[model samples]
Target chain A: MKAVLPDDLCKIFSKAGSSGSWHKYLKVGDWLVLLLSCALVVSSYTLLWRGGVADRAIVKRDGQTIIEISLNSARKTRVEGPLGTTVIEVQPGRARVFSDPGPRQYCVQQGWLTRAGAVAICAPNHITLELNGRGEASYDSLGY
Target chain B: MTPSGIELPITEDDRRIARYTAAAIALTVAEAALPSPLPGIKPGLANIIVLVVLLRYGWRDAAWVSLLRVVAGSLVIGQLFAPGFFLALAGAVSSLAALFLAVQLPRRWFGAVTISLLAAFAHIGGQLLLARLWLVPHDGVFYLAPLFATAALIFGTINGLIAARLIRQVETI
Candidate 1:
């Protein structure tokens, strides 16, 4: 095997401390502004974003618990069901079935799960997602 | 009764603001031609002029130029009294308020770039608040905050750099 040289590895970090033009433009206070913007972005993602949308989401397969997710972070979670893989996409306060291998694609067409008691059921795949929250909820299933 | 209209006096500041307003309006019209991937995101190139006037002239001149630009720009776009017009108004008012305080900071530490960043963030913040309250009427608007904030950081710094460069060029002349 050929020996890997140290000179090649050092090339990767050559641009690290060149003190690019940004250094010349940003002042002491400008750094504060940048940090403030970052804080605002993080706060928007974490706080009060779910006060009205939802609180949590439960993904189940055939009446068995798969996983429970909080509605506070954006993610694309894949769950293995009977038929195939089902992809669930989540925003800060809402969840949706992004894609699924189900034949009818009913759950995917339901779009975002915003309010409480909203459920997206991929029956063919045996995957069901139920949104539970404190917001205004609509009666979905009938037991009477 | 005499039908002749009474003459009102126009000061040099008025003329200067008129000129700056025209420049800002022209930038807004030109910006409208550019394609935007999102509804609230834009280059906001006119801010360079605002920062320039803020430093070159003073707060009063800059304030006049900014507020007039909003009203006049909307009029030209034919969106007078429309919801979009109010969004622009809120942005202008918030940015102007930010500048009013930013300009008072010690020049030794804070500079044009910082001021520009402050104004841009404030502008988007005001627009977002107003939009959530009146337009979308939902918390979904908060989901877009990060995207808008990132845009503010990028464009604010670029516009600040441009304004700094323009100030140097103009001063040397």
Candidate 2:
């Protein structure tokens, strides 16, 4: 066998060819750690997703006056608007709304917004649904 | 027993692989065993070994050890495909790149501690990017905190010191 040179950095490389201690230490970039964190956050979010829709309804007329109602139970809610009442149901996947007072039932078609910055709004009825899964209020009641 | 009272006996090839694998496994165990300040922030003690890997071994070898560490670490932690595992993987990949560059520089130029610190910073940056992509996209910026930054500095320095010490010891041996 050819003698391994002490300064031969390639010796480290060759060691990896089999399976042995070539070096005493190693350094890896933070990228992998960051990726793992992202994965963890996403997984945690998935679990929170199954907690079901956290029912929150906000009613507004002409975008100025507003009244809000929060459902403690996992039940659906219906809010009365100036023109007519709007039925809002909260489910696991998405939040549904029923009312034809506006040009587009934007709120009705708006799918689930699970995380913090997710918001669904209806123009005509002036209603908004904001889902806060990690909210303090939700935790105080029981859990979100 | 091996000469010089060192444990284990092996040929050149065996010694090389063993050291590499030992470093990887040690890092993985450190990662799992050590506690993070927050669930979001970990000390990343493993990166020290990674730095040593990149400097002593070629990038390809370093990559292999990193891959094994992620897979094995995840499996052991049972957090596979979870956010933590991906975060760790990101750090490893970025640090690997940093080390590849560091290795190119003359060994006598920059000390191992300096390289370790750079690798740690790279790991943090990778994590930030991954957060923006997968997790709270808008709030991803929130992931960067002083606590984590401090942890990186402290742990990075520690790893660097350890690497320097190991290098000296290896020379004497």
Candidate 3:
């Protein structure tokens, strides 16, 4: 059977032919970016590990800690926000915004907060939920 | 190539920018449809177009296409003027800046893969910074950096490979 080629493919193949190799493009900059990215990945993971696991989830509204829930229990709670209501669900070792009043539903889209220092914010509702590790606070007083 | 042989009055550079921007926007819109495991982590396939343009055209053209992709892609995805739009804009600007700097190095030593990695890291860094300052306003947000950086590495390599292949094909054409 004769092979059939798409018109665009045929045109492209006929116009010019592959010449240069990818190796020709490799320069010192490539190694630099690669090394830097690897370093960043390593450092970020180190920071994450040092931060430890979160045992509690803190729910805040308008910059005030409204409620703190333990990760050991599984529960769902609803909180009233400026726009409407936000439903927060706490599962084993994780918490998430099951529902939110924000137009974009960003908090809900955050899916879950499982790691220490992870957060989900519903800015329009002025509600923020954060995971807190059992260890000491990672940051000092704000406004440095 | 257009179906008709007749060439338009638009300059070759203008045509290249339009084509590349369209490709990037299409990728962005398609990516938006898929579900992401995390809020911020994405494959960033659209970056392939930026890398290709940078290699083929130049940094200025690549920057134009990258910026156009962010704005037009956001508008298409119904995210214009939203916090997400600003985050995307920040990422695009920083990524372009990183690519601009990376391109300055002796061309023989680096390829799309390296540029993609740099841009990816810069993109995530910029987004995280903006998120910390404007959105979350908490140090905790930085905790997600590891996951994001790992993702950037993986996706950057994939996008770079694809861009390299596409650039080769385009060169042949």
Query: Highest TM-score among the candidates is held by which one?
Result: 1
Q: For model 2, what is the error of residue B99's alpha carbon versus the real structure, in angstroms, after optimal superposition?
A: 1.2
Error of 2 at B121 (Å): 0.7
- What is the lDDT for B170 in model 1? 55
Instruction: Provide the TM-score for each candidate, comma-separated.
Output: 0.68, 0.50, 0.62
For every prediction, compared with the true complex, DockQ reads: 0.19, 0.04, 0.25
Clash count, predicted structure 1 = 0
Q: Write one digit per residue (lDDT tens) for candidate 3, span A1-144.
A: 012432322454465554556554444666677677788789889877676667899999999999999999899988888899899999988999999989998889989888777889999999999988866674532332
* lDDT by residue (tens digit), candidate 1, B39-114: 8799888787788889889998899888888889889988779998899999999999999999998876777888
Worst 10 residues of 2 chain B by lDDT: B138-147
In model 3, which runs have C-alpha deviations exceeding 4 angstroms? A1-36, A53-144, B1-10
lDDT of 3 by residue, B1-173 (tens): 55898857888677668777887898899999999998889998889888988988799999999999999999999999999999999999999999989888666777788888889989999999999999988877777889989999989877886676666676655
Top DockQ hit: 3
Candidate 1: which docking quality band? incorrect
Better of 1 and 3 by DockQ: 3
User: In model 3, what is the error at residue A42, expressed in angstroms?
Assistant: 2.7
Task: Find the 10 residues in a row with the least total lDDT in model 1 chain A.
Answer: A1-10
Residue runs of model 2 more than 4 Å from their true location after superposition: A1-144, B1-15, B143-145
